[model samples]
Target: MATRQLLLRRAAAAAAAPRGRRGYGSTAEYLHRSIVPTMHYQRSLPRLPIPKLEDTIRRYLNAQKPLLNDDQFRKTEELAHRFEKGIGRQLHEQLVAQDNQNKHTSYITGPWFEMYLKAREPVVLNFNAFMSFHPDPKSEYNDQLIRATNMTVSAIRFMKTFRAGYLEPEVFHLNPKKSDTELFKKLIRFVPSSLSWFGAYMVNAYPLDMSQYFRLFNSTRLPKLNGDELYTDEKAKHLLVLRNGNFYVFDVIDRDGNMLKPSEIQAHLKYILSDNSPVPAFPLGYLSSENRDTWALLRKNLLDNGNEEALQKVDSAIFCLSLDDFPVKNLVHLSHTMLHGDGANRWYDKSFNLIITKDGTAGINFEHSWGDGVAVLRFLNEVFKDSIGEPAVSPLSQPASVDSSRAVQKLDFTLNDALKAGITKAKQNFDTTVETLTVDMIQFQKGGKDLLKQKKVSPDAVAQLAFQMAFLRQYNQTVATYESCSTAAFKHGRTEAIRPASIHTKKCSEAFVKEPSKHSTEELQKMIVECSKYHGCLTKEAAMGQGFDRHLFGLRYLALSKAEDLPATKRASSNRGGDLCQSKAKLLKRAGTPA
Candidate 1:
């Protein structure tokens, strides 16, 4: 009891500090201000432009050249030229026409969503991604219950701020002192919402599209036979908690739409934490890790068994807070735990799962179809700043004197024989799938971002070069590599692929790996500089929506949609022609390589 009192006192002291002074002081102050509305720049952001067909063809050929032999390249080039002058030109025109009709959103948005939702594979490691939080500096604050409570309060605060249009606008500041300052905020706040993007632009700042922000809360990916659907319900005020494979929910918002007091929230989370329920015989969460079609059928069976209310509660809640029972043993273990877990305690369909381990290590595993990392990263930065700076629940805070057992409801499903069998199969499948996967880490302690900045080279480009060198040293060959670059400066933008493998990288890797003594130091250095310059150019092109991948994707999608309308010969020729061309090019390249 004395220990408990001391803890509470410490928490209170931590909570009393001004919210912006704890961590990232200057950033916190810049981001938490409500001067610019969250969606103020949405109307003025540019649309993702459709690259010209000839330009896309040129970029595609360049990207493929590094992986192809001379003969193979010529053949692939011929096919590309044929496509460009014939069916590809028609597809490009149609795609542009379609884009013209859909002026409100980017050309890539619908197709990208479709690409994800139509995939039948399980989402665990395939479609979902995890980003772990750095642990709190205060050892006492890392207590599971205290961390959960504080994170919950901070999340609610973010939601309230965002919905009220006060959440800081997502911006890339070219000149922080000039653009991310009080004077800039004061001037920008008076600009009309529609023109606020231009106003920011004038100050050397670019505001990003926040259209995906709405799905950050109260959203879930509902599986279907053909394709999945994204569902969001902002009115839901409940918080879902998964513990020991059991599902529990309680209201975290009051009738007035305000978040519950920190003490009250802590009380309810503590109640859930203290409940010693045994892991279920057939944990329903495992089903969410199954293939989309399989999960869809099982979900139908569940609904037929009169579990609609239970499923709805799971889906409509404002994000999931997974209370893991085991401590993270190491970095690899923590990554695996947060990425997929045992598949029994994870609701993989949720927009994002806020997973907290028994030792209070926390991270988020988010569903990818509804949004991208940009939106999630912003939420993470804000939540981390808020919780660390102005934690609502500290170790010294006491739980409210309320009967939490009555407030929290444990959701129970009426599972039949088929559902139980399905759950067993899903668990086995998940285990088998994860068993084949591996995660490894390497640290370059000698140099990092600061050193790279001092060297005047792109950090990401150098990192890509390292990967190319490593692969060449291991396999004596270079392979096509992909790096994602966000196109979020445009309205409803998605990601564009930045092809990291280039002829320059290939030459540089060869110089370093084939025979170090043969090349002069200056020659190797020049090769590295060339690779970095080309990589930087690729990165810029992709960010500005001039990359070839999306353009080719759009063209192919249009081709498939209009397949039946085309002449039989054209349709047959267009069907996987590009893929066949690339495959044969790779085969020929391999044949030409020395053993």
Candidate 2:
């Protein structure tokens, strides 16, 4: 009785102890961890602040100045001021009140999601973004089956670590030797989850919001009329594989929620890769690339035709992995293949697709509505590191002896005449769309990050400047340019637009393009430095969530919601076309101008 009591007491104490004190045991640690859990900073992370209306107005005008002439600027300034003093103030207050009531998330979260969901354009090139991975150093590891197996095992490991909250928290370490040290981790483990962010902050490290990490696995963007929806099924344990326009699914995780053996997974993937299934005459994957509304309609048809189970399998899989049969000839070919492949062998609706070509060129093409590149890039970095450092499958590793033909299940759709025709139309539409797009690459071997750092200029700023100069030289005029800056440091934060076409850029571009011989090297260098400094400032402001775009967007959205409550005259004036003309006429009449 005494021995049993002692063992029980020890078990209870271990359970009560912090996760950092507990043993990770046999699980492979892909990422180094602090003492705190991955989501320890989520509750304490600051909310995205709504910029003051005046500050927003100032920033808006500053961003607009370079793009407009004197007359255009004057008219824009008048309209901006009028709106700010009128309905904008009320809308801003309302937005603030709304933001206050919803303290758990940023004010822009819902509207930002709505913006993406409500867009009518196809997701292929419009909404999905792709990033290619640099090939593995060993040529043998680049074999399609070997690479796919390794990535699959690595992906499941990531999902397990992330779901169990064992993965390292995403943090920007300004001073790594101090903040990223074991001493920092030991001290931080004592801090409460609520106050953990402050602890990290004191050490000059900023932890990013990990809310989007949930959508990184078992998530899909579902098509709907008017607006789409994001669906995630955390309970699903299957892995969806697309090859030669065919769909195959196999359990990567067992019923006990433990990952399947690496050998078993490799066998299943190898079986699917070897399966010489003929491509579907009307490949239904193309439907995902169609307009959202059309796809929604066709999706209903698919359900009616008894494809709900198959569709659900596709949607609920951990993530889609595509195995391409053809090799990419060059970087452009790789880009084209990864971006919007033949469309038959790709499922564009999944949160992300891990695509591997015949030459083992791998990249991720992800749907945009669920999350930003921050989450995807983190996953990519971790997976790349983990797969390379301790790969579950190697060149010499052989598949399990078990019959994988029984383990992997091929999904088939029951297509009606209408469904078949819809798919055909979708294929044609996808082809037409992709044909209009072109992929090009340029390798600037002369100077890159190291060179720019040596010159004490931001590499990104230099790249942006190059684009501005190239455009000016080509088109003989500067155009509005946008660069995305992430606001992921705040809870549920999205992104802010950084207007890169500043006055500094204009002057520098002109100096380089319009009259290069007229300016001395030192003078031109000074102008470039000025552009870089201003660009850096813009980037910082946008990342800090002080940009004007989202603020103005919120105000406009609020105003539209309250449009009916406005006075009849104001409502009429706020609209476009005839009402705008009538409002202008009334203003002219008030000013004693001829009607």
Candidate 3:
């Protein structure tokens, strides 16, 4: 029935947008009301004033321009657009500070732990909430207050440390222990609402040591940023092209400013990268899991020296297994260096990271969940240009979109809901189709049969198709049909809407069975493109110009359909569903849908 419906009715495209969605008014009205509700305070964080911050950044850039004298350091305006739109130095705390608050940590809100516990289940990405961070700093609360404050401060501090070009460990390592009794207490009191299955601390946190930091000799001085310096201006022009050079990313943490182990961070990264967003079999809070051994170590390290040392020790320059340091990075050190943990993220508040392996081998994982990849790359190129140390050949320009208030809508639906639905839909769709083809950054342009002939087709499309269809085909032998796993994938590794629809049990049913019939590659491509266009266009149309707010949208639809919510004049309409299903079957037949 689900497959028949997909083949006949274009869910998104065919539906005309209803009236009164956000941003339907004049652009001014949209901007006026659209400013994310959180930024009202940041409209005035006095320290590191905009002009002063800009002046400092400009000066810093001037100093590094000579390093890249060989390469023409052209700060193009177009580059800025890309940065603001998708790439740029992003300050997570600013945003987090606005809305990171929420209900206090307890058993009721345990679902929130999904923020850092993405290791349990594979998640289907949803690009719809382009840059959706969890409840802002104010959305909910627990120990996040102190942690988030420190996170923001640490980010700024990190920039300063970077500009200074060095860090010396201020704290040393310390060991801490937790018992099973604590775990029981957590499970009894604070299991997540969404995933009530896990026990406590499925993964453990180990100790952090101080011997892992670096020291600069009397010779070369590296350029970093200042703790007092703001990465951008009040106007946010720096978001355009990183305001000169050097990419920056800030983590939005708890108010208590608790930091996770490097191994945990790496594990977190990989877990997010994997599609099966599994949840821990254990409870996730501090008291929940037995995995807090590393907490004491982190506390001592940061307590003694500050996050400055913590920044340098992030398994970047040194190989942890060989070097023997704090924050074990076994998770990211792939069996071979061909690591695929590039773009996975757990969107809780504004804690973004840039995991870049220097030279893709230097062990330095560069990540920019805030600025993300594209912006990080531009910053890296700028830094490389700056390393050569040359004056700018061209002037810097304005950023792409200073105000992200409405570039994408803040849908009410959670990533979990999207994951559940997307996987199911994609799988069913795949089973109904003959094949799929995808194009991405990995250009398969080699003409020689020696290389090209060896491969059957591009790996990306193959993976997307296999993952989607296979997941659905394996999930449901009977019902749970939602066969379209639409994921929100960012371009150039940046944030974008991904809503992969698969049959729920999104990835269990054998939804990808090859049809008895076959279609040529050209015909398949047209079908896929049309489907993609339908997805991109209809999403907007349904939300009016303002876009779908998942929470609001879901609530409204559910309310209308709920029997209790029906009007007094309205009695139940029996067999309405059966009629619709019958109509759908007829429509698919008319449309020449394959069995």
Candidate 4:
């Protein structure tokens, strides 16, 4: 009894002791810990400030001056004045109130969301972006086993770094203030969420819902009648491999949810390669590559026929790993694979569709709605850099001889004659579209930003001007040009459109088209200098979120919101066609999409 009581007291004492102190001998030792874990800085991040109304209006008018004729400009300027004093002021006030009341991530969140999420079309290449990696020169594309294993290991390592809160926050322009707005971190989280059944993450409980995360590691997007829906199976512990137009599912994780050994991952790849199967009558997956509404209708037909169970296997898998038989020779060619793979082999909606070619080259086709290029680039950069730095350390034993005990199942569909015809039509449409689109890859062997610096011209502006010149040469005309500028320096901010086609750019483009050698070197250089300066200024304004687009967008929405509150008859009879609302509308319409 005495010994039992002593043991109980010892256990109690240990339980009561503080964990840090128990392990440390000094104050520094006890208190010293990770100062900034991966997401630690998120809470302390400051909110994006609202830009003044007058500043935005003035900037908006300036951007339009280059696009509109004198009479048109006059009408726009008059409207701007009225808008500033009338409904514009009221709307700005409301936006300020709304922003202050809820303190939402950004003042323009409502407008941005409306534009991004409420669009009628599917958010593929038009809204989404893709990127490809430099192929591994060390190996042939046929060495899929080694290449895939490297990619898997690199990705796993990147995730582990993120989980440990060590992933570096993206810094822009070497400004500490800019670093305070770490939207890139949010992008990383967004990717996993989009993949994981559209799950939401609470900030405090981050890395929240491990089951949801595990599902994301094995999730895909399903085609819906409207938009796309994410499907993540908590029970799925593997990736779906697509080769020769056939689908195979296998494990990449153990029962405890840990990623399996690299050798095991490679073995799975080998099995998929060694095995062969007959191609289906039609590549049904190609339907997703068609128009959004078409995919929607087809999906309805699919679900109505009780093929949901079979489709679930495709949708619930983490992502499609396409084993292409073609070689990816360069960045441009690899880019093509990432943007539009063999339409038949790709499940385009997956957030992370990895395409590996027969040459052992690889690229990623990411679904865009989740985040922007910068976010994915950061993740890819880490993986690529890590892969290069770390030597390929293979395990001694080869997974105890390819464990085929995984729940490997082939996704089979019962396609009727109607579905087959639909697929055939989809293929034709896809082919026509592919043929119409021309992607020219240019590699400037010598001149780059350094040359631009020496010539005292902004690289971005020069590029935009080059496009203008090229367009004029091709079509014998000029069109309104746009350049996207990041507003990510603000909290939850996205982007703003900077209209690069100014009077100076137009004059320069016309001069080049009319007679390339007529203008002396000095005269051409002067024109380029002016265009560069103009572009740099506008781009700066956009980054500050004082860009005309978001501000004008806020006011318009605010006016609409107020109109919505009134009776339908009152809203209809309010003379919206008159001067009051016309200016804002006309100005915005002329500028095109502000985003």
lDDT of candidates 1 onward, in order: 0.82, 0.81, 0.23, 0.60
- In candidate 4, stretches whose alpha carbon ends up further than 4 angstroms from where it belongs are 1-35, 122-124, 137-142, 164-166, 171-236, 329-333, 391-400, 405-407, 416-421, 515-519, 556-583, 589-595
> Which candidate achieves the best lDDT against the true structure?
1
- Cα-based RMSD of the predictions, in order? 9.2, 9.3, 27.3, 12.5
- Which tens-of-lDDT digit does each residue in 105-146 have in candidate 4? 677665665555444454445554566666665444225566
1-595 per-residue lDDT for model 2 (tens digits) = 6543232223222211122212222365234433667898888887888999888877777877777789877866776676567666777788999999999999999888887888878999988989988888888898888888888888887788877777777776656799887788788877898898888877667777889889988999999999999999999999999999999999988888888888888889889888988999989789999999999999999998899999999999999999999898999998898899999999999999999999889999999999988888878876776677677788899888988888899999999999989999999999999999977888989889999889999888999999999998998887777777777878898887788888899999999999999999999999989989998778767777877878777765565466566444354444433353244233222211101
Per residue, candidate 1 scores C-alpha lDDT tens digits across 1-595 of 6543232223222211222212222232232436777888889887889999899879988977888899878977887777777767777888999999999898888778898898899999988999999999888899999999988888887788789787877776666799888789888888997788778777667777889989999999999998999999999999999999999999998889877888998999999989999999999999999999999999999999999999999999999999998899999999899899989888999999999998989999999999888888878877887788878878889999999989999999999999999999999999999998899887669989798778777788889999999999998778888887787777888777888899999888888888878999988877877888898778767777788888887766665566565434242233334454343333222221111
Please say which candidate is ahead in lDDT: 3 or 4: 4
Per-candidate TM equals 0.90, 0.91, 0.26, 0.78
* 179: Cα error in model 1, Å: 3.2
Error of 2 at 277 (Å): 1.2
Please report, as a residue range, the 10-residue window in candidate 2 with the lowest summed lDDT: 13-22
Clashes of 2: 0
* Candidate 3 lDDT tens digits, 1-595: 6542232223222111111112221221011122211111111211110112222223223322322232322432222223223211132122223223421221111211222132211111211012111222322211222222222222323323322322211111111143123353344234342222122112221111111011100011111111010021111111000001111222212234333222222222222222232332211111101112232232233334444432232212111111101222333233112121211111111112212221122111221112223222222332222212221111221223222332211111112433334334434432333123221333346454343224433333333444555544675232211122111110011111222232221222122244313655565544444434433433332212111122112222222344253242133335423333232222222211111
- In candidate 2, stretches whose alpha carbon ends up further than 4 angstroms from where it belongs are 1-34, 566-595
Candidate order by TM-score, highest to lowest?
Answer: 2, 1, 4, 3
